[model samples]
Target: MEIPQIPINEKERLEALQRLEILDTPAEKAYDDITLIAAEISKMPIVLINLIDKNRQWAKAAFGINFCESDRKHSICAHVINNPNEITEYKNITEVKEFDKNPLLEKLNPKINYYCGIPIVNKENLALGTLCVIDHKPNQLSDAQKTSLQALAQQVMLLFELRKKNSSLTKAKEELHKQNELLKNFAGTVSHDMKMPLSNMILTIDLLKAQYDKQLDFQGKKHLDYIKQASFTLSDYISSILTHYETDKIADKNNVEEIDVNHLLEEVIDLFHIQEECEINFIEENPVIKVNKIALEQIFINLIGNSLKYNDKNKIIISLNFSKDQHYYYFSVTDNGVGIPEDKKDSIFDLFSIATSVDRNGRKGNGIGLSTVKKLVEGLGGKITVESREGQETSFKFSIQKYSQKKTA
Candidate 1:
C-alpha cells in the first residue's frame, strides 16, 4: 500500500520547528524514559523515540536496535505528526511497499510488523519529535495504553519547555552580573584618578599662602590671593565629582520614603541664605513624593546652584512651583540668569560638557552637575528638561512619581 503524501507547507513547518531549537540534539532521558515505559507497559519487543529531521528519522532513544537513522520516505512517525494527539497504527509496515523495501526494515529480526507513534510538541506548537512503540508481531493498542502514551507525550513537551526557559533565564542573569561589575570597576578607577591631582593642588596652595604671609609686596599678595581662589575652585570641582558618585549610589531607588517637599525646599534655601538678596517666590502648596532624600537634595542643590551660577543680575529672581496631574508631580525652577545658547542647549546635561563659562558669581564648576541630576532623575523614573531664551531667562521643568496621600504623614 502506498502512503498518501501529506501536503504541508515546508517553510511554515520548519519555522515552527526552528522556534523549539531541538533539531539534531543528543538523547535526553525525558524522551528516553517515556519510550522505555511505553514499551514495558505495552509488552512490545522494540521501542523508539524518533525525531523526524529534514531527510532522516533520528532516534532520541532506541531499544533492541543497532541503527540510529532511516530515510524519511519510510518513517511511520512522519505520518504520526499529521494526526496529532492520536497514535498512528500500521499493523504491518512490510505490507506497505515504501517501508518494507527499505534496507533497515528487511534486516529486522521479527520483520517489523506493527507501529504506533505519538508526536511531541514544544511551547511553540511544533512537533519536534515523536514517542513511539514498535512490535515484531502484529498487535493492537488497548484504550488504556493509548491514553497513557498521550499523557507521556505531554510530559515530554513540558520538559522541553522547562529546559528552554531555564536556559534563557541563566543567560540574562549572567549578562546583568557582568554589567554590575563593570559599573563598580569604573567607579573605583574614576575616584583614584581624580583624587591624586586634587590632593597635590591643595598642598601646594597651602605652602604658597604660608610663604607669602608677611614679606609679600602688594603685587605678590594679589597673586597669592589669586592662587588661593583657584585652589579653592579646584577643591569644589573635586567635591562635585565625589557628589556625583554618591548621587549614583543612593539613586538606586531602594530608600524612598515620604519626604515633605516644602520642608526640603526650605532647608535648601536656608542653607544658601538666598532670602537675604535673592527673592525665592513659591507657587507650591504642600506636596510629597516617595524618593531618596539625599538624591533629591543633590538634585535641588545642583539646579538652584546652576541658576545662581550664571545670573547676570545682582539680585536674582528665582521661582519654585509645583502641581500634580494623574500619576506625576511636576516641578519647575525659573531664574533670571544668563541664558543658554540655542545650539548648545542639548549638550548642557552631558558630563564634562560646559556650554558657556562664567556663572552668576564668576565661580566655575567641574560641569558634572547637570549630568548627575539627569542620572538621579532617571534612576527614580523621572524626567527633566531645560528651556532658555537668549541671555534673558532660563527655566528647568521636571517631574517625579508622587507618593499617595495615605503614604504621606
Candidate 2:
C-alpha cells in the first residue's frame, strides 16, 4: 500500500495540531455526539473524529469502533488532510490499487469496502484531522450526506479552536496571578526596609531643633521643618504602597462579621482624632451589616480624613448617611471640603493622583489615600463614586454587598 504524501504546510499543520493539546485525551460527550450524528446521517456503521498526529491517526471520538489509533501510513484521514478543500471518497477500497492491500482493510471484521472523509481544517487553512465514515459494502454517499458530513467536520474544527482559546486564557490568568504575588512581596520588603531610615532622619531633625532652639536662624529652622515634612510624606507614600499590595491578602485572611455601623463609625472617628470643632452627624440610624471589618475601617478612615484635610470652613460639616436594597448597602459621606474639578474627577481614584497640590490646611499630601480606599471598596465587591461642585462641597458614595450566610461560607 502507498503512503499518503505530506501537505506542503506540514510543519505548520503539525504545530497547530500540537498546540490544540487534544491528542490522546479522554473521550468527551460533545465530540462523541457529533460522531454519532455523522454516522446516522451517512447511514454508516462506523464513524470517527480523528486527529492526524506526526506518526499516527488518533481517534478523538469513534462510533461503532473499539480501536483508538492506527498508523498514519494506513489512515485514510491522513491522506484527506493533504487535499483539505475536497472530501476523499472510495466507493470500493478493493478497486483502489493504493489502498486495496492496506493492512487496516485486510484486518477489518466486516471487510472494509467504502470510505468517505471530510478534512477538519482550521481558520488558517491548516488541516488537522478528519470526520470520516466507513461501510462494510461498496457504496456512494448522496449529495446531502456529503454536505452534512462536511458541516460536521466544521463543527469539529470549531471545538478544537474553542478549547485552545480557553486554555490560553487560563494560562494568562495564572501568569498574572503569579506576577501580582511577586509585586506584593517586593513592595512589602522595600517598605519595611525604608521605614527605619525615615524614622531616624525625622528623629535627628527633631533633636537638632530642640538642642539649638535659640542659636538656629529662622530660615535654618524653616528648611529643617521642610525636610521633616518631606521625609514624613515619603514615609506615608511607602506605607501606602504596602497597603495597596497587601489589601487582597488581608481580605482573604479576614472573616466577614456583622458590624454595628454606629460603633464602627465611632471607632473610625476616634482613630482620626476628629477635631472637636468639626460638626459630625449621622443623618440616620446606621444598620448592622456583615462585612470585612478591616476593609470597612480603611475605607472610612481615608474618606473622613480627606474630608477633614480638604475643608476650608471654620466649622467643617460632615454628614454620613446609609440606605439599602436587597443586594447591597449604600453609604454616603458628604463634606463641605474643596470639591474636585470636573476634569480631575475621572482620574481621582487612580494611583498617586492629586487633584490639588495643597489641601485646605496648606499641607501637601502623597495622593494615595483615595486610591487605596477605591481598591479596598472593590475588593469587597462594591463600587465607589463621587459628586462634587468645584470649591463648594464633595460627597462620596459607595455600595457593598449585603451580608448573606452563603457569602460567609
Candidate 3:
C-alpha cells in the first residue's frame, strides 16, 4: 500500500496538541488502563497511547512495549493524526514510502508487522494524537476489535478535549491577571499626573484672589467667579474619572453581598438630593438580591442621576421593577429623561461614548458610567439592554444570576 503524504494545518494542529498538555508526562493509569483493556479486547499484545509531536512520537501510556517513544519519520500514528476521520490499517509497513527507510523496521523491532491506529482529536477539529494496537503477525485485528478500538479512541478524544479546555481557562485567567495589573498601574499614573496640575491651579486661583480682590471692579469679580466655576467643574470631572476607576476595581474584586435593592436605591436618591423631585417607586415586598453592592449602588446612582439631569420636566418619574427567568433575576430601571437616539443606542455602553446632544449641560458626564455597568454585568455573567427614543422614555434592563442559597446553622 502506498503511504499518502498529506498537508496538515500545521500551526493550528500543533497548537491544539500543545494545548492538551499530555506530552512527555508520567504515565496515566486511566489511559494506560484503556490501552490494557484494548489489548485484551483486541487480542493484541501491544497497545499504545501515542502523541504526534513536532519531530517525534511520544507515548502517554503503553502496554507490552519496552520503548516509550520513537521518531515521527517512521510513525504510523503520525499518519493517523493527519487523518483523524478514519482509522488507518496496515497489513505491512515495508510497502509504505514513509516507513521504508526507517530504523524501526531494520535495526529496531522488525516484529511489528501489523498496525491499527485511531486518531485522537480535540473539539476544535484539530487532531492531536493516536491510539493504536500492533502485532508481530500481519492482519491480526478482526472487525469487532476494530469497533472496540474506535470506541476507545472516542474516550481518548474526550480526555484531550478536557485537557485543552483546562489549558484555555488557565491562559484566560493569566491574561485577566495581567490586565488587572495594567489597570492598577494606569490608575496610579493618572492620579499623580491629574492631581498635581489641579492642585497647582487651585493654589494659583487663591493667590490671584488675594492679590486682585481689592483692586478689581465687578467685571474682575465675575471673571474670578468664572475661573472658580471652571476649577470646580474640572474637580468634578476628576472625581468622575476616579469614580470610574473605582467601579472597575470593585467589579474586578466581585465582592457580592445580600443587599436590599430598595434601600440602596433610596440611599442613592437621597444622595442625589432629588429624593423629593423624583418620584421613586419600587416593588418593595422583597426587593433583595445578591450582588456586588457597590456596583449595584453605582448602577442605580447613574441611572437615576441621568434621569434627574436630563429631564426637562420638573418632576421625574423613575421606577424599579424586577422579574425572574429560569437562570437569572432581571432588574429594570425605567425613566422619563432626554432619551438616547436610536442610531447611537448600540454604542451607549462603550467607554468614553457620550450621548449625542445639541446641549451637553453642566452634567459633565465622563461617559464611562454605562461602560462600567456593562462590564460589571458581564463579569457577573449577566446582561444589560436599553430601550430609548430621542426625547421620550428610557429604560435600562439588566439581569444577574440567582445565587444559590448556602445552608446556615
Candidate 4:
C-alpha cells in the first residue's frame, strides 16, 4: 500500500500548525460541534478534526471514535492536507484500480468504503488539518452534503485563527501589567528621594524668616515667601506624581467598606479649609454604600476642591445630591465657579489637560487631580462627567455601582 506523501512545504506547514497552539489539546465543544454537523450532513458514523503533525494525524475533535491519533502512514486525512486547496473523496474507491490495494480499505473491521475531508487552511494559506467523515458502509455524497461539509471545514479554520488572536491579546495584556508595576516602583522611589530635600528647604525658609525677622527688608521677606511657596508647590507636584502611579492599586477589593456617604463627603470637605464665604448644600439621601471608601473619598475631594478653587461668586455656592437605585448610586456636584470653556470640557478629565489654566487663587494647576479622580472612580465601577456654562456654574455628574462588579468569588 502507498503511504501519504508529505507536502513540498512540509517544514513551513508544520510551523504554521504549531503556531495555532491547538494540536494535542483536549476536546473543545466548538470543534466537536463542527464534526457532528459534518457527520450528520454526510450520513456518516465517524467524523474528526484531524490535524496533520510531523509524524501523526492527531484528532482535535472526534465525534464517533475514542482513539486520538495514528501514524502518518495509516492516515487518509494526511493525504487530504497535501493538496491544501480541495476536498478529497473516496466513494467505494476500493473497487477502483488506484485504491484497490489501499490499506484504508482494511482500516476498519467492516472495511472502510467511503471517506471525505476538506482542508483547514491558515492566514499564510497553509493547510493545517481536515474536517473529515468516514463510513464503513458504501455511501455517495450529494452536492448539498459536499457544500455543507466544506462550510464546516471553513468554520474550523476560523476557530483556529480566533484562538491564535485571543492568545496574542492575553500575552500583550500580561506584558503591559508587568511594565506598569516596574514604572510604579520607579516613581515611588524617585518621589520619596525628591520630597526629602524639598521638605528641608521649606523648613529652612520658615526658620530664616523667624530668626531674622527684625533685620530683613520688605524685598528680603518677599523673596523668602516666594522661595517657601515654590518649595511647597514642588513638593505637592512630587506627591501628586506618586499618587497618580499608585492610584491603580488604591481601589483594592479589600479596601471596600460600608460608609455613610454624607459623612464621607464631610470628611473630604475637611480636607479643604474653605475660608471663603461658601454655602455647601447636599440633599443627603444618607445612602450608606459598600464600596472602596478611600476611592470614593478621593473622587469627592477633587470635585469639591475644584469647585472651591475655581469659583468667582462672592458666596461660593456649591450643591451636592445623592440617590441610588437597585444597582447603582447617582450623584451630582454643582458649583458657582469660573466654569470650564466649551472647547475644553470634553478633554477636561484627561491627564495634564486643563480648562481655565489657573484657579481663582491664581495658582496654575498641575492637571493631575481630575485625571487621578477619574481613574479612582472607574476602579470602583463608576463613571464621571461634567457640564458647565462659562461665568455661571459647572456641574459634575457621576454614578457608582452598589457592589463591585469584578468580584469573582
- TM-score, cand. 3: 0.66
Task: Identify the leading candidate in terms of TM-score.
Answer: 2
- TM-score sort, best first: 2, 4, 3, 1
Model 2 misplacement above 4 A? 24-29, 252-254, 275-277, 312-315, 406-409
Looking at model 1, residue 59 earns an lDDT score of: 77
Query: lDDT (0-100) at residue 55 of candidate 2?
Result: 94
**How do all models score by TM-score?**
0.56, 0.89, 0.66, 0.87
lDDT of 3 by residue, 191-282 (tens): 65887787778788788888988988889878877887787777766665676666656664347788887788778878876544668778
Question: Between candidates 2 and 4, which one is better according to TM-score?
Answer: 2
Task: Record all residue pairs in model 2 with backbone atoms less than 3 Å apart, i.e. clashing.
Answer: none
Report every candidate's CA lDDT: 0.75, 0.88, 0.76, 0.85
Would you list the clashing residue pairs of candidate 1?
A: 309-359, 309-360, 310-360
Count of backbone collisions within predicted model 2: 0
In Å, residue 8's CA in model 3 sits off its true spot by 15
383 Cα displacement, candidate 4 (Å): 1.8
The candidate maximizing lDDT is: 2
Q: How would you encode candidate 2's per-residue C-alpha lDDT over 1-409 as one tens digit per residue?
A: 8899989999999999999999888989999999999989999999999889999989999999897999999988888999989999999888999886899878978788899999999989999999999998999999999999999999999998898899899999999999988887888998999999999999999999999989999999999999999999899889888888777765542468878998998998898776547988874775887888888888888899899888878889899999889988888999988899899999999988998888866888777888888888888778999999988899999988765655653
